[model samples]
Target: MESVRTTTTRPAAWLMLGIVLVALNLRPSMAAVGPLLSAIRSDIPLSFSLASLLTMLPVTAMGLAMFFGLGISRRLGERRTVLLSLLVIGLASLSRLFLDSAPPLIASAVLAGIGIALIQALMPALIKSHFPDHVALCMGLYVTSIMGGAALAASLAPLVLLHGGSWREGLALWSALALFAAMAWQMQGAGSSPVAAAKAGRESFFSNARAWWLALFFGLGTASYTCVLAWLAPYCMEQGFSEQHAGLVLGFLTAMEVVAGLAVPAIANRSRDRRGVLGGLLVLIIAGFCGLILSPHHLGLLWPCLLGLGIGGLFPMSLIVSLDHLDDPQRAGGLTAFVQGIGYLIAGLSPLLAGFIRDRSGSFEGAWWSLTAVMALMLLMVLRFDPKHYARHIR
Candidate 1:
């Protein structure tokens, strides 16, 4: 039963700007913390294991939220929902400045993650519904801005402290960015109105084995991403890089992701079968992990460069692959939402897993090796993503 569905859209440039700026807000609250973990721990008595919650809590919230986020947007409408999410994020980020202990800090991170999840849930439909002709371009822009925000926060936070500011300030200043985005969203809110949605079928996503595979694939790939995002700076610090330099490496790595996010989709657009490209990216990831494990000091910069190129490409590609599984935007959105839901729940554990490994082994080597193996597993999984299976396996 296809019921009437009404959705409002306008193709103005400000809406595009709104999308990019909002995308920028999604990552900084989480990304800024990794480099400063050493500092945060110094003052707050936060162990590596407990500190993992900074990343894990938010990501876990995001994963859990994806399942219900679309419904929230429908009831509240996307515009107001986006505004509310932004304020939640801004207030959460602002709260970090006053927080004195681990629990409050982590709670704020979860709040920020919920905010990110709410906006993330609505963004694809908003972009696709409004910028139908430019869905690909807008998506690429959205993904890249996410990376760009990480890059900015990672690079800037250390610089702030290096110049004599407190780490709290470094973490909390991102609230200002969220505020700016909130204002921009308010201005563009009228243009991108409520989505007229019809009730989707009650079919359980859990019943689908193919959906599980895609979810696992996306989950494992994200594990690698969130692990690095949470641990890379601290790992580099363990490598004896200066605090500033370690943050820079993480920043550069995320910047490379921004570059790859844009380029990978364009390159993959020329070929329907993305397995070959996926394989190549996995090889880079494996090699980068190898370098990080074997030689911590020599050619240190090269490792993040390679890892950035590989992981960056893989993230967007994972979503693209899931999207490839179905042509209908509505169906693809549902499939991708299901994938991200389970995938992020799986991804959220990685940082905690890495932190636990560190607590046990006294080094991050075990986590790196585990991640390397997982990437290799992903390499093998690519062969299964053959385009021929898409239609047969879906709908």
Candidate 2:
């Protein structure tokens, strides 16, 4: 066994900026659809479950694609895989401009999901490879960009749709972001080798247990966040808030996430071991979920605000943990794919189940309570994980 560090030289500032720029476009296509669900549902004649499916299918697809994405990355290389995914996402997002029916819309969403899966799976590895010393700082910025994109899309999608006179234009706006990401990635390191990267990843990732725990944390944490992302608007509506107000609340919640996204990973990384930090985050999420279930209406922005912050921290911490636990940066990619593949499948069920619970119980409260239960399970899992290192061996 040997350790290799690739030769690369650039100012730290520019590398961070470029990574964030690429990260910014990663989730806009997915985030934009949630805020506009009501309008899409109203215009398209979708059943409640079907409308939720439009949202869940892409997330589900992202997860499913991730299951085999590592093998794909092994063959294609991480950089090319990411670039290819961005191109596919860009094209799919743009195609939504012409879709008036559910099937076409669903297809476009699935395409975007596939692209997102590729990008999400590869990013931590890219960050580790490119910014070995600044994993925490760079991950903070990367997560910031991710939540920033989601917040921007959530806040602005309504305005875009209003001004463009259609939801199609709003949804298609992500295509431009995707194009920019593709160009930035191309210009930065066009000659980087992917086959070497993939080979390197395989040797590093397959022998680790900590990688699996981190992946579980990433998956479960992300699942919780996506559950909220997918349902926040509808929950608001059910509570009697106007669509515009609900959208804004959701936007504000996402904006609050930036605080956690940047701060938690930095804080967690400071300690050699992250279990205490992980425990703290689980507590915050518990508190936030409780807020949503017990006081969402009364506290107004308080519950979502707290949940958003907790979620923000959770996302970056999970990603940073993946990098930290692995001795090799290359392993970060495959580990990421596995985590996302499993996590998104868990998350993909959230919106659908929330809808089912809503229909079954005639209320969204039951859904919130259910989310609280998931968070509790996630907390217990994090407890068994020794965050400073990988599990000694797979038991």
The numbered model that scores best in lDDT is 1
> Could you tell me which residue pairs clash in candidate 1?
6-196
- lDDT tens digits, residue span 59-161, model 1: 9999999888777766677677788999999999999999899999999999999999888776766666565555556677788889899999999999999
Worst 10 residues of 2 by lDDT: 1-10
Per residue, candidate 2 scores C-alpha lDDT tens digits across 121-187 of 6667767777788788778888888899889888888787666557888889788888888888767
Q: What TM-score would every model get versus the actual structure?
A: 0.94, 0.90
**For candidate 2, what is the TM-score?**
0.90
lDDT, each prediction: 0.85, 0.74
Per TM-score, the best of the predicted structures is: 1
RMSD of each: 2.7, 3.2
